[model samples]
Target: MNENVVVSADWLAERLDEVTVVDVRESWEYDGIGHVPGAVNVPFDSFRDEEGESESAERSGSDPRDAGTLPGAETWADLMGEAGVSADDTVVAYDDTHGVFAARFLVTAEAYGHTDLHLLDGDYSSWMREHETSGDAPDPDPTTYEVRDPEHSPFVGREEVEAAIDDPDSVLVDTRDDWEFEEGHLPGAVNLDWRELVDDETRGLKPRDELESILDAHDITPDKRVVLYCNTARRISHTYVVLSSLGYENVAFYEGSLTDWESVGGPIETES
Candidate 1:
């Protein structure tokens, strides 16, 4: 499986024994309803900072952005350890609600320079339907995991996003729903809902040819530097993973999405 890409259910089912699967649902969903057999339960919130919020123009250092902040460095490592994840392990993450939260986990992992991470294709709901053996995943043996700044990172800070807005060759995509896009969006952003990248029936990413066709029709070409954002950045990261898998090497995601944009009083536009 390609690291930092989406993995089909078939690809994952065949390699379950070889990789570590992380379920990013909350405690109630995981410990209550159940999860993929042998999957580790890593609630999505673990990666976000509950205390330290991100900076916005309105609050500056005072108000945190709407998106979740990263937890402390060692704290991230411990969370991985609790899931029995080692630095070398090929990890796959999923969530019941689309791949939003799951993608966040992968993005956070990428920030820490974790390699070989994948998002399970289809939402967790479909996976559970087919697998049917949902229950508590065994408590994983603790292991040491390291967090470091990678030589190259996939995140786009507010400053970089602002720069991209002015670069003619760059494409900034707003990955929120149509209603949200109509309500308001960042300046010069093209609206492309996150759902468009995946098949509704299968909840799996569209084939490359199909995806390319759609993107070409929308003027989202691979040649341009791409930046994505949503209200909370989760949807943006999901699209980021899909685009990266499609060989988009120069892509980045704005962690502070529209809400953050609004927070800073960034210029916005709406449909007439």
Candidate 2:
């Protein structure tokens, strides 16, 4: 994994005042359970659209698939602005859910052209074990976050995913549970649960060699373009961060994922 994308607790502790720490947990958890000092709360749900209320639906008529879709770029800018995060600020995001939600936040930030993004190596539980916490919320001074053209597109649409089904140089990875994959998955997609990439105890990514070995066993190599997806792109976000941090240059995620796939009658293969 790239050292830059995953920061150790010690590293964060040293630079706590220099970086913007975001807790992607819910508001209740942020207040009830305490968080890293000076951390801001930006729930993972902020990146998504409400069911039947997406901006896409407003423009192109309502489609069930539009629900939970990623909102437009301006919305993302507003989210960052409301959270007092500027585009140039170095962001370190964390959550209790094994960094899955935190990874989602990082991916969204990258999509909107934020360059310096990192995931706290372990979950809040691990951090609490080693670092101090605070129940007092910081009153962040909001800033104007201007959205610019993204340097790289980390999200792929349904059409691109459809074409990838037949592209030998591309691979579609279903980062969901075994039972979920067994029930049904995209044609030619391989199952590699997102949990497999995380250390069960630390709730952080596994050791470098172990991660490489796991990916190698699944034939997910750096040379090939990788497209990851889960039910609604939440679970796959974790794998996307892992692949990108591992120096996979051609990695992108299906933002709509299986929810949109099934909505449009996209082909699915069941493990029999």
Candidate 3:
């Protein structure tokens, strides 16, 4: 968890100098309005196609390629290299919805051995809330990340998940929306909407009080051995960072989520 995630808005604000903050929102958001100062716009969808192009169609459910079994390491490395991310640099990524896309960005970075990655606790909404009085948005420096080794991402295999299922202390968290959770989910998994992590109006993650309430409601304590998975694991990884921000320990993400679950012959159940 320590290697893959970073938490605390104050912690990120303090290191604004050393870290490269990225806005991984949709290209439309970047093209229409603007983005954070000194931050680059790298959408999570950027890694879908082979040449690092984004599919901007905005489909529901997670992308299948995000599963560990889909794309090859070389493909992902090329995608990161096209983005200009450095292995040595500390990266901070965020998006409109909690940090799902941001987590995708981080996972890809980590796969390439960019260990110093951080997800902005609440992301764009949090930034706006802190700078509400500020008027003009700062210009973003046009930059791209360079990928090194794409094969190094943290993706749990289906076998790992099956092993954990009966392990008693292990917890699987589903990061999809509430409706998605109600429809069907991995048996024994808990549902905590990723939105709960941030403030509603500003869209930034909630302060400690709100974050605490969310954990309390989900029965997620700091010491629990937790693993998060969503339709394809992108958003759940983002949720992992949020949980890390709240000081939850022993949290990890399943690389291939529901898609892989069914593929591996894992059972599922509707919420009763």
Q: Give me the candidate number with maximum TM-score.
A: 2
Better of 2 and 3 by TM-score: 2
Model with the higher TM-score, candidate 1 or 3: 1
TM-scores of all predicted structures: 0.88, 0.91, 0.74
lDDT of 3: 0.64
Q: Which residue pairs show backbone clashes in model 1? A: 49-69
lDDT of each: 0.77, 0.82, 0.64
Best by lDDT: 2
lDDT for each residue of candidate 3 in 65-175, tens digit (9 for 90 to 100): 343533445666555555555556777887777666777777666655566777766666666665421223344333354445434333555666677777777777787
Q: Model 2, range 1-272, lDDT digits (tens) per residue?
A: 23479888988999999999999999999999999999999987877665623232233233222334555677788888888999899899999999998987887777667888999888798779899999999988989997765666766677788899999999899999999999999999999999999998888899999999999999899999899989877788889888878888898677778877777678999972
Native-vs-model 2 lDDT?
0.82
Candidate 1 local lDDT, 1-272, one digit each (tens)? 24448877777788888999898899888888888888888887777774444443433222122234656567889999888998788988999767878988888887777878898888786677666556766878999998766767666667788898889889889888889889888888898888888887777788889999988877789889898888766678788888878888788767667666776678888962
The order by descending lDDT is 2, 1, 3
Candidate 1 lDDT for residue 14: 82
